[model samples]
Target: MKFIKTKLLLAIMTSAIISAPFAIADDTSFNSEIKKAIADSKVGISFRARYEGVDEDGINGASDIEATALTIKSRLTLQTGDYKHWSIGLEVDNVTAVIDNYNDLTNSYNGSDSIVIDPEGTDVNQAFLQFNTQKVKLTAGRQRILHNNQRFIGGVDWRQNEQTYDGYRIQYAVNDTVSLDYSFVHNANRIFEENSKKSNNLSGAFHFANAGYKINKAHTLSAFAYVLDFNKAHAMSSNTYGLLYQGNFGAIKVNLSAATQSDAGDNPLSYDASYYNAEIATELGKITLLGGLEVLGSDKGKAAFSTPFATLHKFQGFADKFLGTGSSTGMANGVEDTYITVKTTLNDVKLAATFHDLVSNEGHIDCGTEVDLIAAYSFKKDYDLLIKFASYSANELSNDTHKLWIQVATKF
Candidate 1:
């Protein structure tokens, strides 16, 4: 039965993709519009090659794991110009393993090597039909959606294969200062590629809504609500509501957010948790300093707040030690992340460093501390070179681990 439903959904999407242009075309100028649209369409291509190495201390008296992976991703995208306020977009991506010594955490898990999440596969990254006007925009089919810094929702573009959604999205600009955005997501195409043995995709009824108001030129406030009901991943089903505020005061900037989550759908857990983030940033001479505290509160060690759909690597720490929070395999005690970052640019090279102090929210267990460093240089308009490193020292959390990455990318 499930297989039949899946096939039916795919058929509908295929039909929509094939018939969108005709559905939006006018009978009189259909041929001319089609020709014009093709003439004005754009194509994009990009490639990224990276090498990652990981070293970890032995756990449970097992041998220490050391591994390296070299991988490359190629992407192609096309965007057709508007014809009667309608357009089409398509993106395809392929990830290839040049050196596969490390476990991909998918079909390549060898039990002895450190894990790298970049699996090898080719798939459609995004395919969407969009209709746009001055104040309103609508999109349907597989698409990428990012809301307000991607703390709650985002396309995990950092990975070899980005995370995208099969969904419908709409955006409305209510005058200049107020705006609204919403998406109804039916499936989540995760970073784990289609060939993975793991549950690489999630089928769900997910609704995301946000409203933004510009209080003034330097201040913006937004409110959001997300309801996620996964068909198979019941533990991740939850309802979250939050408010965010960003302010720029002369040389200083402030960001504050607060959210709450509760069990929903068929989730067996009955719990409520709170989430909070506060950060401030300011520039000093050639350097920028940022400090913040992010807390994912716990419900008496039974459940914790989690952002399963977020770009998890951008938060907690780059080592990704706390990505499994709120799930059966995750930390039920929740987490408290206190961190600071320094960024500077010199000689056309961008440099950043961050430090994190992690601990459990309920049990007060010291999780670990991590230091991350990154240096990136962009040249020749569309070329980039990057080097990054992370070291995590454990206390009560996972193992002591270190990771390094070197990457070069070009897009045109």
Candidate 2:
């Protein structure tokens, strides 16, 4: 925490030094307006609060009644405009409850943290500083990192306070179609606190690097490599690397991604994880169609684990089907799944539906199938109303009954 604070202070000082000479520069209309805004204090504010509920369900013989969760988040943004180019961002997050156990969605019991996020925790959600120009952009602090669809990689979203990285990042644009992206993390506020055999410790530093490229107007790609050297006692850590490709052809688009990971072994942890996901989307006038498949593999019979510390809402499904590994340790080590979605717009209203089927990648036993429905209507203004519903039924486990949810959001 102290290291992150020092970096933040350093960024502020750097920006101040670069802008000192501009204190007396002759100002034009645009420049004067910018100066005035800064004088008044370059600042912005944003907030979000959401409520969700799930109907009765059972998971692995455990019974779940109905349950609900509420969360609120707010952010403050400060920026500067000068030949120096600089800005600062900070975020605050709070939640009313964790994933209610009655709904059976709470997957945090053994090993790592749970997949859902309405958890109990406090501290700033994020804080970062940025500098940018037509050619280069740089930022440092605790912040959110989002890529493509956030499938194979992502912060667990089911929580009110999302995941954030305490780090520095840079980007350089080579031209209209090509660019470079890089980042370094000194800390990761994972979804849950570090569960020592007895005490809960959630403090640490981790590092990583990432880059992106565009092959053409219709094709784009990205790559990443990271090493998570935690601040505490855990051995057999791992290194991760991956590639992603996306392409568009007129009304149709396809995305293919692959990743490989290696670990030294965590105590008795079965190290290494690999996963891939593919999807195709087609525009049919007012309606869009989507179909995709995903698979996770491990040396043992377990699903390749994603960032359990991430915002889980960004993965598997909004219903959060595949929250974590089907098994952290087992002989069958793999999980395969597929799904399809349909999206359409009616005037200012949007609608979408999805279906999913899952199973052990190396076994024939059915994991389950889920259906999700969503709809939204936007007022000519900045306000919008939304409704979401999810349902899942198991083919074998009777306790795997079902779950449901509904939500609404507004912004200006």
Candidate 3:
């Protein structure tokens, strides 16, 4: 009978992990039912758990080896104080992949191996609400929005599933360093896990707005406008404006940004994409030198996109690689590909390098190329240990790929 109910849910999840630290003090009466559900309601709850792994090489359908996951996030809050400016937030995530989205497990226990979880399951993730005064800050349900170097609209955090925006957000602070932000998704819980976090059942969705400027001494600038209404019909939406600059001279620190995108109207292939990002850092005393560059531009079939709301491995290259969308010939279209990163850190040792040039900005073909390497170490201030590797080569698409990532992250 279904392998005895999958061996009784893997023996009740391996006896709840050997009785969970002696039953965690009997769960304190279910955490007092979450503090009596906010006892007179000023409510608050917090939780977080993240685990990730990726070791690949199965020739570019993505996901080749060691794909592990476990994202158990719970955040709940409700407030009505600070003088009625208002606040309310709710987040619940129950992602339990527990190693196998690309861990391969010999391709799903060679078939019919069902422990039931992730048949496109587990979510809620966030249910936003906020309103602040002193220069406006208004937010409306389902949030997690990001901008300014999110490349387009962040909050991916290298996936164990992230990307939230059921829709509506706005923040304006025009002084004390300038600010203006807006996000409108209307739909996109995405990340069951991909295809733009999937499920846009179609009927129109996605919109964005931003204007950030701080120009006085070593600048900060942002301007963005976006719209994506995919009710199918060749689905396309675009509008973007960008500029960013960060500065420091004595010890060397610089950041530069430039962007230009068009095609919010007039489809039938109008095309757009122009981006250039540069970063340089220096320390020389304990070895902390870094370099960066990010580029994506090619409009042959409307590609060059990012910011599915922010944090795609912190600006494209934590080796999650291209973060999604882009396929040649039959079309996937997202990652025209261009990369360069060199890093350094000394203390507990960390070094990194990356190189990629997969061409085909459509009729701008070269098809594929990649090279990556990393090393990390740190222990006794919490913990950290990592080693990563990558090599992908596909000329004119398909065949040749390899990836590996080993990681450890913790916070308390």
| lDDT of candidate 1 over 1-412, digit per residue (tens) | 0112353357447746755665465566786787787788899999999999999999888889988999999999988888888888888888999998887777646467888888888878877789999999999988899999898998878889898888899999999999999999999888985556667789989999999999999999999999999999999899999999999998999999999999999999999999999999999999999999999999999899988889989998888888887775688899999999999999999999999999999988999999999999999989999999999999987999999999999999
> For model 2, how does the per-residue alpha-carbon lDDT over 346-392 read when each residue is reduced to its tens digit?
87679999887877665556777878788888675755566777776
- Flag the better candidate by TM-score, 2 or 3: 2
lDDT of 3: 0.55
Clashes of each: 0, 14, 16
RMSD of 1: 3.1
In model 1, the runs with Cα more than 4 Å from the true position are 1-28
Quote model 1's TM-score: 0.94
Candidate 3: misplaced stretches above 4 Å?
A: 1-82, 88-135, 138-143, 146-151, 161-295, 298-321, 324-359, 366-412
State the C-alpha lDDT per candidate: 0.89, 0.60, 0.55
User: How many Å off is the CA of 234 in candidate 3?
Assistant: 36
Let me know the TM-score candidate 3 reaches against the reference structure: 0.30
- Per-residue CA lDDT of model 3 for 30-120, tens digit only, reads 5454344334346555444444444445544654444454444444444423324544555444444445444312222443221112222
Ranking by TM-score: 1, 2, 3
RMSD per candidate (Å) reads: 3.1, 5.3, 23.0
